[model samples]
Target: MSTNPQKVHFIAVGGAVMHNLALALAKKGYQVTGSDDEIYDPAKSRLENAGILPQNIGWDESKITDDLDAVILGMHARKDNPELLKAQEKGIKIYSFPEYVYEQSKEKQRIVIAGSHGKTSITSIILHVLKYYNRNFDYLVGAQIEGFDLMVKLTDDAPTIIIEGDEYLSSALEMKSKFLFYHPHIALFSGIAWDHFNVFPKFEDYVKAFEELAEGMPKAGAIVFDETDNMVDVICEKERADVAKLPYGAHPYEVKDGVSYLITEKGKVPLKIFGEHNMKNLHGAKKVLERLAITEDMFYEAIQTFSGAAKRLEKLGSNAHTQIYRDFAHAPSKVEATTKAGKELQPDRELIACYELHTYSSLNKDFLPHYADKLNAADKAAVFYSPHTLEIKKMPAISAEEIKKAFGREDIEVFTQKEELENYLKAQNWYESNLLLMSSGTFGGSDLNKLTEMVLALPTNKKEKAKPAAKKGSVLGKLFKKKS
Candidate 1:
């Protein structure tokens, strides 16, 4: 809160947003310093370039001096962190990343996008449109979006700040959901699907968090939500009477030659991004932009060039006959929606969907049943999980049979090794086919772009051909195949 150059220290600066925040503060002439036990590329490189990278890898209590203006705690830091203890003993003010962001944008009109899925895409679209119109706004998006150098941006003089409100825990000490602290003046709720099993163990508890978000909005504040979701409808109807409520759904769209076009009053506007869920996200973003006085024409023009947030249906590589996409879709609902979208983009081509069980929720045996039939849209479905990951998480070993049973599909293939999964994919003929890899974590550090190229480089005639179909209800058909 100091007007002059303040000394800010980050406890865990290696995080995606944490490093960005450190760089942003440094750029604003603040004396910024941070420490992290392990720093990954991009974050490490960016922080080092900004000259804010910690001299050592571990926590140093000496860095937490009384002269420091404020200490920003990242979620990755533990309650017993030495620097955190020192800051507490010194009576220095400490704030979680979300709490600090709220403090910086409290005076601005905050626009928050909240949902278990599609929040990143919606936030990306809003930022894209605002940037295109030359609007002066600060933003904190989850993913690295196009045209934005950093994921977190803060300035002294922006009238508006757009935020992607995550429903996860604020910090190790806070335990409160991050979105609850933002106090959004204009909020958009895409939909609530049960996620983050480690935090909200019960489905009702997860839904209640979103309800609290709606209830926290100030009087006269506006809320835009997806009306198609029954849970969202119930929450908005019951808890949002004090605020103005607006509902939106999928915009009218048509896909031509593998390109999706949004049908507007102006005409068919072609889009770089495709998917029914993305179209719905677009509609939600449109409503939010309308509240900001951004015209429909401006929204249409800007959104046509918006590729998408990184790792959200991002096209890795493509050939004339085939295309390869990678998406951050670990939740069951996201997997289903993304798989269906990938299949719909090229309906005539064979769709091969491969998903990795990476997140704590997805790797939990109890939560595996939720994914049943989620990948049914794909012609050939595969699930991959690293046994080492389960060991590291201290979870019990899971069998391929268990995964197959959980999926309720007898034909689904499961792999425990990344190399085997990669080889299996390379063995398939990719001509006139589409491949979608969905996961929150990398498939055990396998290079997706190289694998995509390997598949595209295969000879089409050397691979197995599709089998001919038989007539339904015949005796031979009953013996050969099962009914859908």
Candidate 2:
């Protein structure tokens, strides 16, 4: 409750995750203070509204003293940060965000969703079910879900906590994965592929995180995993004897009249979402929920109205003639799943997939080969990235051809200019087609919703024959037919 007011200082608290945590602590009546080198939009407004934004933008060693109970460090903070050095010198207790999360979640039964791509979706699904049933739970999710305003929640009343476990490290001081601190009683692995090249550096090193998860679990803990993922299968199969390992693959489903329905013994469960990848995600969620004692019937009921996490498969804009969808897919495995998932919905429709090499792992030349043939499912594929971004990140410059070769696609289209790509897209024919945009970051700050609207407004024509006809019905009519 608001009774205890332990003072907590945050160093580099402007990060997406850190800001949410700071807000959570303050709402619980703890005195919270934070600083960042530069506070940008949204985060700046949020911190100010919380009334905990530091007066100065940079860290001050004078701010750290023995009076503070704890200091939470963000990933953006450097090892030699003035405040961090001062905290160490004064013998103050310092913790990375993950370590602090572990301390908070220790009393609750933890349910962690881990994977390269679908962890956010899986965690959202479980949280949605819990919300629908009015169950009390503390949670830490990656994205802002429909019912939850903030991403992190800490409360003594909630006996359970759901976590979207990321493989990234805690901070510069701790070289361990964030999920390692979770020590989940119920853990799910949707899949694993190489990521975070700047840290792990090798594919095997990247794969070791999951292995550690399996090894650390208690014998009675429930471990759910995707049997279809080779790396996940290998890791979970070798688990400790006392740990109960449960495997779930894709739930058998059918696409009927452009809609996906899960075939269940009780009845067919209708879903608003499409794609086999989502079906796999649904299966994984069901297993995890069942471990938490949620009935199968209830799980299906809660997900009926679930649109999805914001921007995982966001509808930017659309007209009757064409549709545009954007996804937060940047890793190689994610690219493969998202591209193929779009195509699965409309087999005959031309699928144009665009991606930006935004993440540190994706931009590294040494790690490029991991993405080989990832975009093969798309009829038209393009890679867009900013040279200025590489310079800002201090990474080596990469050319369009290098991306093409790395992906092993000779016909790959690459662009350095956002306007040029936008102009080119505006000039293309969007009729009887689908557009899929994949990236972890915005493509040079171009508003995808605006682009989607532009593509959707393209003149639509109808004809009894293959030739164009007078303006009639919209593009969805044609794309839906192709899927059938």
Please tell me which predicted candidate would have the highest lDDT against the true structure. Answer: 1
Please give, for residues 48-144, the per-residue lDDT of candidate 1 as tens digits. Answer: 8889888889889999887898999999999999999999999999999999999999899999999989999999999999999889999999899
Worst 10 residues of 1 by lDDT: 468-477
Q: In model 1, what is the error at residue 304, expressed in angstroms?
A: 0.9
Q: Go through the candidates in order and give each one's C-alpha lDDT.
A: 0.89, 0.84
The number of clashing residue pairs in each candidate reads: 0, 5
The list of candidate 2 runs beyond 4 A from truth reads 460-484
| lDDT of predicted model 2 | 0.84
Question: How many backbone clashes are present in model 2?
Answer: 5
Show model 1 residue runs off by greater than 4 Å.
Answer: 1-3, 239-242, 462-484
